[model samples]
Target chain A: MNAYWQCLRGIVLREWLRFVLQRTRFLSALVRPLLWLVVFAAGFRAALGISVIEPYDTYIPYEVYIIPGLACMILLFNGMQGSLAMVYDREMGSMRVLLTSPLPRTFLLCSKLLATALISLLQVYGFLAIAWVYGVQPPAMGLLLALPALLLVALMLSALGLLLSNGIRQLENFAGVMNFVIFPLFFLSSALYPLWKMRDASQWLYWLCAVNPFTHAVELVRFALYERLAGLALAICLGLTVLFTLLAVLTFNPQHAALRKPG
Target chain B: MNALTVQDLSFAYGPCQALCEVGFSLAPGRFAALLGPNGAGKSTLIALLTRLYHLQRGEIHVGGHSLRDAPRAALKQLGVVFQQSTLDLELSVEQNLRYHAALHGLSRRHTDLRVEAELARQGLSERRREKVRALNGGHRRRVEIARALLHEPRLLLLDEASVGLDPASRLGLNQHVRQLCREHDLSVLWTTHLLDEVHADDALMILHQGRLVASGQVDALVQEHDGDLGRLFAGLTRPTATGAPA
Candidate 1:
């Protein structure tokens, strides 16, 4: 019993404490979405128009359309940021200490991912509260429904981040990942604009948005804000979470070259 | 029972071999030193012993548990201080130890008591609350040593842990580790490039170019070379004109 709680307590506290130690990291997580909410959304409000979507009964402002995206942006960056911390820990040798423990490596890694997901959830709520101050408020009951959706998105994103961290060899290579993964993932999804708007530009972009797992993630949050359920979003997000988590575990397997320290 | 054993352990990186046909074993409570120069594969061997890498050819066992078949159990019986500092500089000494203890699943009540006992055992109680960044190099090493012992492992492996320390600190650390082996009946495998660090009774293995050329008690090996361990080490490791197959 002590062992079970310790595993949960240890990794959770360690991950949270690491983020707390760097207050700037948390601020940056909040600030990035805030920038999108304030400057980018303000500038692009007129350029992009919105039709009444399924989740929105009446016509809604563009600021409201992108709020879900900004919430997702927080989860995306913060989740990957946690993975980056793992790489730093590996290079600094503290990862070796953690890896040598008696606990199964899978459990240890999962514990970390769960902690990261929880932190991402907190950041999403913080961003939502800030967005409310800007006159973009979800139904008060909608906020309650958003919790489970936010958790699912965070889990999926954090798993993807862990998988990438396990594969990347050097710190220098991580920048390329941000551009290839975060940039494309955020841009190709329904984060910035709805899929129908992308179809107006190109069928290919719309198809990309249709297949993107992130599209489902944003859709999940968007509908939750209006007290609606996204069955497709739930399936896609949960499926991707399991897929990415399996990849992470395989990559960290003792047989893998990248996971091992050179003798 | 042997505390640790390795049989024909071999590994390679792409085309370059890192370890080839390496083998050794240490009895319970014995102290052994793996002596080699830079790029001689001493660090590589330590990595293998710690199960940081899986070998293509060979077997490693700790207290009778196979590394390949039971890594978590094997690792639980072994402790390691790597060549690089593993301490979290942003955390205090006690925080670092507590984090490790929790990972090993020690209860909060036990972790506190064990942390105090370990700090006292490592002669670090006075500095327990100090941030790791504030500690000097030697003190940081001490923190790592105390951390490796927090779980009370039967085998301890140190990879070039004394490098860059002042002479007095190095001697102090060596003495302290040797004392731990005696007091706790822990088997120790210490890797170092410095010949002076090898004691007369300690078993020594000379490795060069990924091959083990010599293994025996230091005093016996020195006697075989007429009381010249350095010359023997060089002659065995230096490439000969014939370049005989290792």
Candidate 2:
């Protein structure tokens, strides 16, 4: 309906305004990925030599190889941080305002996820732009091709974040998400090292990387950035985005959090 | 027809009962105060009314639409100002109001008109561009009230909306809402612990320990009990007293 479109536009506009106002958040989002690309990748390049991977047709520098992962890293952090904001919103009464809207709760939450995903794209591209300037350039067209892939990954991660936030009753519990979810999802995936390298380290660890959804998200972006298609990664990311979004919507009961404390 | 109705509404959290067999109604354009102490199930009732919590038992009808079966319709006619301020501090007053209007699915033209009207109504026209964080508590509350009325709902529920305001601001807020009720034919259900907020002519419902113990016109309840408002409220809500539930 017209109203639904207008509502989505409004939600997205609010997020865009907030994103513009929070200069530090934008800077920090860029800094984390840039750190990995500049400092960590530089240090790790000699320590880890990447062979010709499926997405890479030939030998590539460590920085180039890790570009997709680091790009996704921005999304991963932004996704979780956006959900953390949701927890804060719950405590601060803004979430209540959001939920009490006349639109269907499902639609409202989905709009939020999409808006946050769109904003995360801005950060991802911003990081990529800086990476391009840093001489870690993807093909010009490849960078454009990666937009849809980045969006899919962003939605998947944001949905996953929202799903996690539903179970997180308080902001204090978010540290656990950082340690348990973000760390494991990032470190255990192909984000830092190729799955074959993980196989060289340990078979079980390689399997964990192979099965990690973030691996698919990374591969999806990695392949797209090289102007290639990653069918399996695309399928997996799409499926998980849908599944996580559904689970988030189903479990997001504000009353559960509101009533968690005894009256 | 009554603008709002709750019949045998009850809720429980784990083994603790928060509300039990609560029933009440507000005629069109009337101002009703839901007077209750801190732990007297006021928030729980508001939560249920606003659909934040699923109804465990009983039925609520807003503007003739049932909450359980027709929540969207029911909610369309109901507006709420929660105990906590819900405005985004980083957003300008106009932006906050526009967001709310958008959530209610107002068209752009309608939103612009409503936003203009509400800003004027709340005496916030000059402060429209100001971020909510810069506004004092009273002005923020006014913004919230204006936002709530943007959709022109038949029933406006204020759950402890006057909390943290100075006495003068509190009285002014109450009077403003009362004026809205008179001018717009708006039905209001205001929840608060402050007895002074309730006037003699207003409909009064006393909720104590998860039950509606007393409800009627304030003057009639006071005259029948042969005491002032404070003594009557204390006598009914006192823990040891056996106040009959209405």
Error of 2 at A43 (Å): 1.4
iRMSD in angstroms, per model: 2.4, 1.6
Off by over 4 Å in 2: A257-263, B241-246
Would candidate 2 be rated incorrect, acceptable, medium or high by CAPRI criteria? medium
Error of 1 at B157 (Å): 0.6
Judged by lDDT against the true structure, how good is candidate 1?
0.86
The DockQ figures for the candidates are 0.57, 0.64
Give residue B246's error in model 2 in angstroms: 12
Best by TM-score: 2
**Per-residue accuracy of model 2 over A1-263 as CA lDDT, tens digit each:** 98898889889999998999899999999999888898999999999888887777889889998999999999999999989988988888888777777789999999999999999999999999899899988899999999999999999999999999999888899999999999999999989888888898999999989999999999999999989999999999999999999999999896964444422
Could you give candidate 1's per-residue lDDT for residues B3-99 as a string of tens digits?
A: 9999998888789888899998888999999988787888778767776666689999998889889987788889889888988888889988988
Give the 10-residue window scoring lowest on summed lDDT in candidate 1 chain B: B237-246
Q: Proportion of native contacts in model 1?
A: 0.66
